[model samples]
Target: MTITIDRRIYNDSVISKALYWLSGDYLIERSLSDNNTESVTITANSATDISETELETRLMQTLNDFKLRQIVADETRDIKTILYAKAFAEDEDLSEEDIHD
Candidate 1:
């Protein structure tokens, strides 16, 4: 099945993550068009009885999950930096309460 995805909504990294997961079940061939769209051709394994529509749905869901994860990571980046800095800091005078705040 041939699936077209909007690059504006789904970036290359997100599509790559989705394809990596689905690659075990399907042979994925991907390409980008001048119109800022991505084309994915998925060929299911002969041993699997998966439908094209089902495969497409799974890919979409995977892409969405990756996008959400990216957003969450971006949002928490500063918090992560703060937590790591606190954990690894060598300041003996620092208290746990200061880190939590």
Candidate 2:
């Protein structure tokens, strides 16, 4: 089955991450279109009972989930870095209250 995804709605990183989960079960190929869209072709490596519509729905859901995760990670990167630094610092005291703050 092949699906075309808008690049504006889903970036390559998110798509790649989502496709990684299905790599073991499917043979996947990707191509770019002139209209700023990505076309992904997915073929089952073995026999399966899933319909194309169901697979498309699942792929869309997975892509959205990964995009949300990517956004969260991007937004919290600085804060996470600080937290990690504090946790590893010998001179800095990382308290439970500090985490809440």
Candidate 3:
């Protein structure tokens, strides 16, 4: 159950920053399990127990704002007709089973 970054990580920056926080920069109670064991451990910066308020504050302050809405808009706008067709066909009854020969 050891925590690790997925190998197919499309966003390395996001994963790195999250890993840094999980390793404890501002000191938080985040924990990950040991492989093949139930051993408990704290991050390297575990000088004291992490407080919820402090964790929340650090988390809120470290957020990276991006043009998420704009990206979503572009994706959706380009596929409007495709989406409409899919929506129209979604209500059609179909067999759940797949038959392969």
Candidate 4:
């Protein structure tokens, strides 16, 4: 099974980051439609599919790939707080040194 998800937001920086991922090793652009509101689409094929759960597995993998990239950078720590601070901010009280996720 194959699935594609796309959304066009008003922010260019976010679009640039998402586009960088969309264009993968063998990504297909498929068909696209646009308007003054927002250009977005999804294309998928389950016709010649062999695997029983390929669709679900691949979708989960794709979502995880993006989630992994959304982690805040260490360089931005100065602008915010440490893990401890974040913990406190959220009232969790975790250590900033606990870098391993």
Candidate 5:
């Protein structure tokens, strides 16, 4: 089965992450169009009872989930970085005030 995804709605990173999870079960190929869309083709590695419609549905869900995760990660990157630094820092000056500052 093949699906076309708009790059504006879902970036390459999100699509790649979603595809990585299914790589073991499916032989996947992707191509980019000049219009800024991605064409993904997926084939089962082995015969399965799952229908193509079901597979497409699952792939869409995974892509949406990863896109949301990517958004959250991007939005929180600065805070997350500060928290990690605080967790591993040896200096005592890294405190709540430092985070707020």
Candidate 6:
């Protein structure tokens, strides 16, 4: 199976994460095009008989999931830092209101 994706729409990190999950069932090869596109080629494991369409669908789904995770992580970075500080700071007397604020 072979697929091409727009680099602007899906970043390298997203592709890498998706490939990591798909690696269990397929041997994935990746390349970049000068036109700002990414090309991915997959060969199913010997024990698997998945079709090209299904593999492409799964790759797209995995890519979407990784993109969502990245968005969530980016959106919550500041909040996560505050949470960590509230949980482990030396001065641990932060009130509920302080933490929320």
2-63 per-residue lDDT for model 4 (tens digits): 33344432233343454455444233343334432323332333334435366446544655
Q: Supply the TM-score for candidate 4.
A: 0.28
> Which candidate achieves the best TM-score against the true structure?
5
- Candidate 5, residues 1-101: lDDT per residue as tens digits? 99999989989899999999989989999998756899999999999898999998998999999999998888776677677787877573444454432
Q: lDDT of all predictions, in order shown?
A: 0.80, 0.88, 0.40, 0.43, 0.87, 0.82
Model 6, 1-101: lDDT tens digits are: 77899989889999899899888878899998766898888887786777778778878998999999999888776677667887889775544555333
TM-score (all chains, Cα) for each model: 0.80, 0.87, 0.25, 0.28, 0.87, 0.83
Tens digit of per-residue lDDT, candidate 1, span 1-101: 89899989988888898789887877889988666898988887667777777777877899999999888787766667667776886563444444433
lDDT, residue 101, model 5: 29
* Residue 79 displacement in candidate 5 (angstroms): 0.5
Ranked by TM-score from best down, the candidates are 5, 2, 6, 1, 4, 3
Q: List the residue pairs that clash in candidate 4.
A: none
Model 5: ten consecutive residues of lowest lDDT: 92-101
- Give the winner by lDDT: 2
- Name every residue pair that clashes in candidate 3: none
lDDT of 2 by residue, 1-101 (tens): 88999989999899999999989999999999856799999999999999889999999999999999999998776678668878787676554544433
Between prediction 1 and prediction 3, which has the larger lDDT? 1
Decide which is better by lDDT, 1 or 2.
2
Cand. 3 Cα-lDDT = 0.40
**Which candidate, 1 or 5, has the higher TM-score?**
5
Tens-digit lDDT track of model 3 for 6-101: 323313344345446556344334232333222222244545565655654443343232134334555666355455655787774433222121
Q: Once model 4 is optimally superposed onto the true structure by TM-score, how far is the C-alpha of residue 53 displaced, in angstroms? A: 4.3
